[model samples]
Structure formats: structure tokens, C-alpha cells
Target: MTALTLQNAIARTEAGRARAAELAVAMNIAIVDAGGHLLHFSRMDDAELGTVDIAIKKARTAALFRRPSAAIGEDSQPGGPLYNIESTNGGLVSFGGGLPITDEGGRTIGAVGVSGGTVPQDVTVAEACLT
Candidate 1:
């Protein structure tokens, strides 16, 4: 399987950042390899200071789980199948801004996450980077 490269990570970060700008929201963005290792990150000026770790955690959660973090978030709600799962894996972020990065072969090569915007806006920005 092909791995995510630094160049691609940087490109993706820029793309996400641009989308966040278009949304008129400052953001903290993170890209992580399939192994949940951070490959790139950016904090837009005026982004919420608290969102930095959240962005990284979201990317790691998506990369390690190979699914959008929002799905996990849904499942983790009360009475859901994955209830309390957020406590696992050194704290997985179950939120909308995290998405797996899939390759042409349909393999998840990495993930991207954005924070500091509303959940929908964050998701939109991250999705823009994947396209």
C-alpha cells in the first residue's frame, strides 16, 4: 500500500486552509498517516487555541479507524453501539471534521481534520482537501 508523503500532506493542509478561509472561519487543521502519526498541521491566525489538540486527535481518530470521525461520534452517543468508545485509543475524537484519505485503490492512506469552525464548516473544509 502506498503511504502518505510529506508533500501531499502539505498540499492537503493548504487546500483545507483555503477552504476554511472561504468559509470565513479560522481553523486548526491536521493530517495524519494511516498509522495515526501526524504528517502535517496548521493553525490559522485567530483560530481557537483549544482546537489545536482537537484537530490532531480528530485526524488520528479518522486515520486509525478508517472512517469519518462523525460516524464514530454518532455511534458513541448514548444507547449507541459504540457508546463510551471515545474513551479508548488514548482518547479518540468522535466529531465531524475528521475523514480518512483514501487512495485510488480504495485504501485509506491518511486522514485530515479541521477544528475552530462549526462542525459542518469543519467537515466542509476537510472534504475540500480530499477532492
Candidate 2:
């Protein structure tokens, strides 16, 4: 299977950042390659420092787990020891606004994360690129 490249993640990150800024959401956006390494990231002019770190963690979580961060959030509830495993392994964000990017063959190749906006708005921006 073809693997995700840093270049692709960078492009997607740029697009996601542009989209987030256009929407007037002061957010931090991050994109990670399939290997769960940071590829590109951006913070809006007025975005908070914490948002940047959270966004990166969110992207890494999605890429490393090969699922949306929201899914992790769901699994993190009571009776889900799996959530603990995810966190222990690192790169797990149990929150919304993180999405995995899959190839045509349905293989996840990367992930994008957006923060510093409402849940709906963040999810909307993240989904915009996943599509």
C-alpha cells in the first residue's frame, strides 16, 4: 500500500489552515503523516498557544490510531480500558475535530486536526479536508 508523505500532509495542513482562517476561527491546525509524525502545523494570528499543542496531539492521535479522535473520545468513557491503552501509547486525543485521511483503497494515510473553535465548527473544518 502506498504510504502518506510529509508533502501531502503539509499541503493538506496548509489547506486546512487556510480554511480555518477564512472562517474567522482563531485555531491551530495540524497534519500528521501515516507514521504518526508531525508534517505541518499552523496557528492563526490570534490563536492560543495551548490550541497549537492540542491540535498536534489530536492529529497524531488520529494518524497513530487510524481513527477519528472523536472515536477515541467515545472509547475513553467508563468501561473502556482501551482508552487507557490509547493514552499510554501516546498520541490520543479523546475529543472532536480530528479526522483520518484515507486513500482511495480505504487505507488511512494521515490525519488532520483543528482546534480553537466550537465543536461543530472544528468538526466542520476538519471534515472539509477529509472529504
Candidate 3:
């Protein structure tokens, strides 16, 4: 399988940034390979400092789990099967905004994460990124 290339990562980041701009929100975007290694990152001019790490962790969470991070969050709620899963994989951001990037064959190739906005906004931008 082809690996996640810099060009692919940059395209996703740019798409995400455009979505954030359209939403009138500054955001930080993180793109990671299938193995959860960061490949490309973007911090919009006014994005919060705290969002940098949060964005990266979100991408890592999605990449590691091969699903949207929010799915993990839902399953990890109190008394759920994956309770406390956020404490694993060096700290995961199990909230909305992280989504696995899958190829046409349905293989998870990477992930995109967006932060520096509300959960819904972040999720929207991430969705646009993968559009």
C-alpha cells in the first residue's frame, strides 16, 4: 500500500484551514500517518497555543484506533467497554475532530485532526479536510 505522502497531508491541511476560515474560526490541524506519526501540521495565525498538542493527540487517537476519535470517546464513557481509554497510547484526545483517512479500498491510511474551536466546528473542519 502507498504511504501517506507529504503532498497528501498538505492537501488535507489546506482543505481543513479553508474550512476553518469559512467558519470564521482559527484552528490547528494535524495530519498523521497510519502509524500515528505526525506528517503535517498547521497552526492558523490566531489559533490557541493549547490546541497544538490537542490537535496532534486527536490525530494520533484516530490513527491508532483506525476510527473517528469521537467514536472512541463515546465507547469510553463511564461504564462503557473502553472506559479510561484516553489514558492509553500516550494520552489520546478522544473527542470530536479526529477522523481516519481511508483509501478507496477502505484501508486506513492516516488521520486528520482539527482543534481551536468548539467540538462541532472542529469536526466540521476535519470532515471538510477529508472531503
Q: Among all windows of ten consecutive residues in candidate 3, which has the lowest summed lDDT?
A: 1-10
* Model 1 regions more than 4 Å off: none
Q: Which portions of model 3 show Cα errors greater than 4 Å?
A: none
- The positional error of residue 101 in candidate 1, measured at the CA in angstroms, is 0.3
User: Quick one: best lDDT, which candidate?
Assistant: 3
Candidate 2: segments with Cα more than 4 A from true spot: 81-86
- Report every candidate's CA lDDT: 0.92, 0.78, 0.93
TM-score of each: 0.97, 0.85, 0.97
As for TM-score, the candidate ahead, 2 or 3, is 3
lDDT of 1 by residue, 1-131 (tens): 89989999888888888888888999999999999998899999999999999999999999999999999999999999999999999988998999999999999999998899999999999998897
lDDT (tens digit, per residue) of candidate 3 on 26-51: 99999999999989999999889999
Comparing 1 and 2 on lDDT, the stronger one:
1
TM-score, model 3 to reference: 0.97
- On the 0 to 100 scale, the lDDT of residue 72 in model 3 is 96
